[model samples]
Target: MTLSTTDSVATAGTAASEQPRPEYPRPDLDRSARWLNLNGTWHFEAEDADSTITVPFAWETTASGVNRAWLERGVYRRELSVPMEWEGSRVVLCFGAVHHRAVVRIDGSLVGEHTGGYESFEFDVTDFVVPGILSELTVEVEAPADKRAIPHGKQRSIPRDDYDGVSFTPTSGIWQTVWLEARGRTYARAVALRGDSLTGFDVVVEAAGDTPADAVVVARVLGTGETVELRTDPTGRAAGRIEIDAPRLWSPADPHLYRVEVTVGEGESADTVIVTSGLRSIQARGEQLFLNGERLYLRGVLDQGYWPETGLTAPDADALRHDIALARDLGYTLVRKHLKYEEPIWLHEADRTGMLVWAEPACPSRFSAEAAAAFEAQLPALVERDGNHPSIVIWGLYNEEWGLDWDIPGSDARARAAEHAYETMRALDDTRPIVENSGWSHVRTDLVDWHYYEPDLAEWKRAVAAMAEGTQDEFPVRLGPDFVVDKSYYASDAFPRSGVPILNSEYGEGFTSLERAWHLRWETQELRRHDRFAGYVYTEFADVEHEAAGLLTADRRAKEWGGLVPADVNADTVIVVDLIPLRAGADILPPAEPFPLVAHVSHHGTSPATVRLHAAWLRAGAPADGQAAVAARAQPQSSTPRIAVNPFELSAGLELTVPAAPLGGRLMVWATDEEGDLVARTFIDAAEVEEPNRRGARSDG
Candidate 1:
């Protein structure tokens, strides 16, 4: 029988008599079958000493119940009884993920060992297991995160550890679901499905067996009240072209998914696995990213997969889906899963929820040729595992100057390694965007990206403005202290890449500090609340413990700035007329121009009239004469007023109307109550008022 334990297991107290912790191994690919959870009461101990540790969570984590220091290496022992029904072809022991190193043995016989903290590994246990007998399984896991030369991205080094909440927070032991799979002599090993809008999708399936059996790939597009099916060849490589005329694109608003089912084996003995996919293409047309053919904007958030209690492991499927849904609700179309790679379930939930993902490969701190290769080698496994999910649109190889020793003697060696990594990933799946390195160092790339976190908002805004003006590559000198606005500067040269798709990738860690009432004293956290409004967006959504950066609070509370920015005087908070073209004063305009612009304005907190543009005025000019300004007394009573013009003599051919101005008027129209109390306003041409000025600049003055 598989071992088991209670939901919460500790390392010190529980005896070996207790059962395994988690009973089921595979959470994603689940089938109605009898299995055992090898968690619970196991003979566990810290790496070197004889002291016992917990079964699942590492000794250091609170969930593990040990709360003791585990020095790099750890040993765990457990026993299981194999049923008589398993006296068959093959029995595989799978470990979801075992920190930095792992070795497995059954009935005192060595089976297999693996080194890698993020990926899963399995060993063939058929030979070691005695039929109809209790099999004693012992796994020795050596995960020295800080000292080890493994890809433990952001997992703090031992002893002098800082738990500021980033990625890979000492998640040791069997973090994922591990199980024994009883397979037939011939079984499907792995499969990959890649899709794009232009060329048809390809379905490649691989199996392990003595004979070559035909495999059929059947694809069904689900949406628009119909499911379209396409059949592919089972022998060798099979593909089908699904020409979608007007494909329904998947975004935060509309997350559409398609399912492709593959059947392995000849007839009755065949097994089917469903691959969910999305038919979309991401390409840089100049500097803008086009989804389908429209320019795409990525309102993204940095999702560093971490939980206060669970650390790396998610509580359940709903826990994974909750983040995606929250992001969508917060108006973010994309989530840059910063630094670390997430579980397959998170990506799957993203696919179903319609959130775009920029999947970054975990990176190491030090630079070495061999280390790069190891990273490169792990790419195929990662891509193959996550390629089918439509949510993952881009694969981020390296992040923020990690291991870029371009200044060192063998700099080109590292560059070549990076190039190889990039090319190898492209070779596997060219459908999505791949970055050799995300920021700082760049070579051949689909998009340019950078990270900045300065408290001055102006620096970030200046960078954004310069990028909007098509700046690329060059770093501008910092503006004076007076110009600095916010505390962080994470802007990149994405504007030049604007013709291609661009991304803000990272931003919004520092939010306004607000206070929540606590007892007699006021307890203040790093809560993000815009002064003009509170409880709108939020702060520390992800509990970035030390970083103090997030759109949500540590305990998942809406710390202000949570909901949609309510309507107010400002453009973000307020709503004004949707004026397409505000006609110049003297020029004979379209019938729509001379009409009174009406808007169903909404409010945030203040009344409509209270939101007014101070020193607001209207100006009108003539085509014949140069220009003229109209100074009208504030019509406090009327929300919609017809501003009569200073009639020019040329009003005869101009339909006896107002003169045109080189620039449009800045009107202060009062949207008030019956008692002339300013409730709201119509800030005439507040946004992009200079657009008309730029257009007029080209005129022969």
Candidate 2:
């Protein structure tokens, strides 16, 4: 079923109305005294109508009480009284995010202007503010209708269509929190924390202003009582390393974080910022991706960061936390934040909740010298802002050749551009692996990835078999017509065959009930059977508008198929089946004909054991009707001994015949251990015959 536009956590009731996103905006570098939350009500003007709307929520969202599309431009005004305590400090006005371009003014004086909708920006408003009196603050936002030049991720001015299936309604005005912070002359502008295998952390602190030579940066590990002091150089920067004996590594199972306090000055001139750090490292060796020296497989989902009522912004902090918890409950170890830079709060939740993140930058549709310059300029600041977060492991640059029209693989221009972007990212931070452009046209990348959405199960099986056999020529046939066969860019022979690890980053048919669950299990097994495969990420975690392929509805409600799979398929004890009789797109069945049903079951549990296969047929009816039709038992199949890394398969075939009838029914198959414990179950439906035909004539006629 399709989700209503207004049905969401934000519109449910007053639960979120009382306090919406009241937490500190920046959790990575937080200072309560130096920060203020401007997320309540503000004077808003849209379409020449004066109204009051929520600050952080975009004007176009229902949460703003102005549930309408934004025009070319909008205005937001708010009056603020600067605290007397911040008299001698630098009062900076900060904006979490504003869609497109924003111009700021205080008391009718222009302060600063910024472009780009996803990153944070701030201006020092100390000169314009009266310490104890109210000051008028105005923000002008201009969101153009053009999608080619702007780096608007999945946002379209018009309704979504086939050409832009993933795009949603455009959001304008300030979509994130606006606040005022007071800091000393010399303060910590940013911090970078790197984790080493030897339980040591290399910390680099960047200060904003000139340093006092005597000023030393003090780093204190809050709970562990570990401290390190380093003196700043002539440039007001300090770098040092601190070792933690026997550190507790951070993983999806245990997301442990260490609190750090960084102080730049001493006595009354001191400025302190609290930071959070995690002890973890990610590395790619040969054909495998490892985390902290252990082989890791990323079972992830695609998160678009959209809300029914709030557009790109989440309704509140609780809403963000709920999405993370939901993904984790469905057996996902990671989430790829697709095509948008999310708020720091979302990454904070991922860090604490034990879910890894694959972060990507928003991209423009058309390429130009100006567009390339804008992307390059934002890369360093983006890395500096989100570098300390432990949850983000993979840094995805561009997606599916969004900006570069000539991003064909072998082209020198495409290769040069991709290499330049890669070098730019590596210069800023060399901690995570960079995927130059996910899905296609891989010039320089650490991991080779692909996006496939073939609905035919047989074709998908063949495609995976070709990958296992290293037969690249036969891949196009098994990949179906939807697969792009252009080898001009990939050069046919040079296309990802060895060295780097390969990932099927996106794949899902989005069917409902039994069909969807069957497809998921079958596709997952196909990838796992290939020895060189690193991992796979399903197409999505929840539905987004016209893209109804998500396992959950757009409002985050679980579908009927949610209960069909095990609690955690990543666990050791699991069974997956690939049934051959239930063909894709085959809804009708012929009765009175014998057919062979083959089931290929893969056992991933510990220890070898015997399992029993049972089959039953039931007429379509409610449970109370008790319309049982037939039952059978196949010979027991013995599975091989449990392997830690690879799954062992067991195949069995049975011949069965259905009685000629007009009634529709379901064929149910179950796999159980020797102790009668249910491992997995699947069903294939048989359509009802309208009328019996004899000699090419209907009986009713």
Q: lDDT of each prediction vs. the true structure?
A: 0.50, 0.70
Provide TM-scores for the models: 0.67, 0.83
Question: In model 2, what lDDT does residue 372 have?
Answer: 64
Give the poorly placed runs of model 1, Cα more than 4 Å off.
Answer: 1-41, 48-56, 82-90, 130-132, 145-148, 158-169, 197-201, 209-252, 267-269, 405-410, 471-500, 509-541, 562-701
* Stretches of candidate 2 exceeding 4 Å from the true structure: 1-19, 157-163, 209-214, 473-496, 510-515, 566-578, 581-701
Error of 2 at 473 (Å): 7.2
Tens-place lDDT per residue, model 2, 204-318, is 9877644645467999888887789988777778899878876898877788988889988777667788888699999889888888877777788888888888888888788
- Candidate with top lDDT is 2
User: Over all chains combined, what TM-score does candidate 2 have?
Assistant: 0.83
How much RMSD separates candidate 1 from the native structure?
A: 14.0
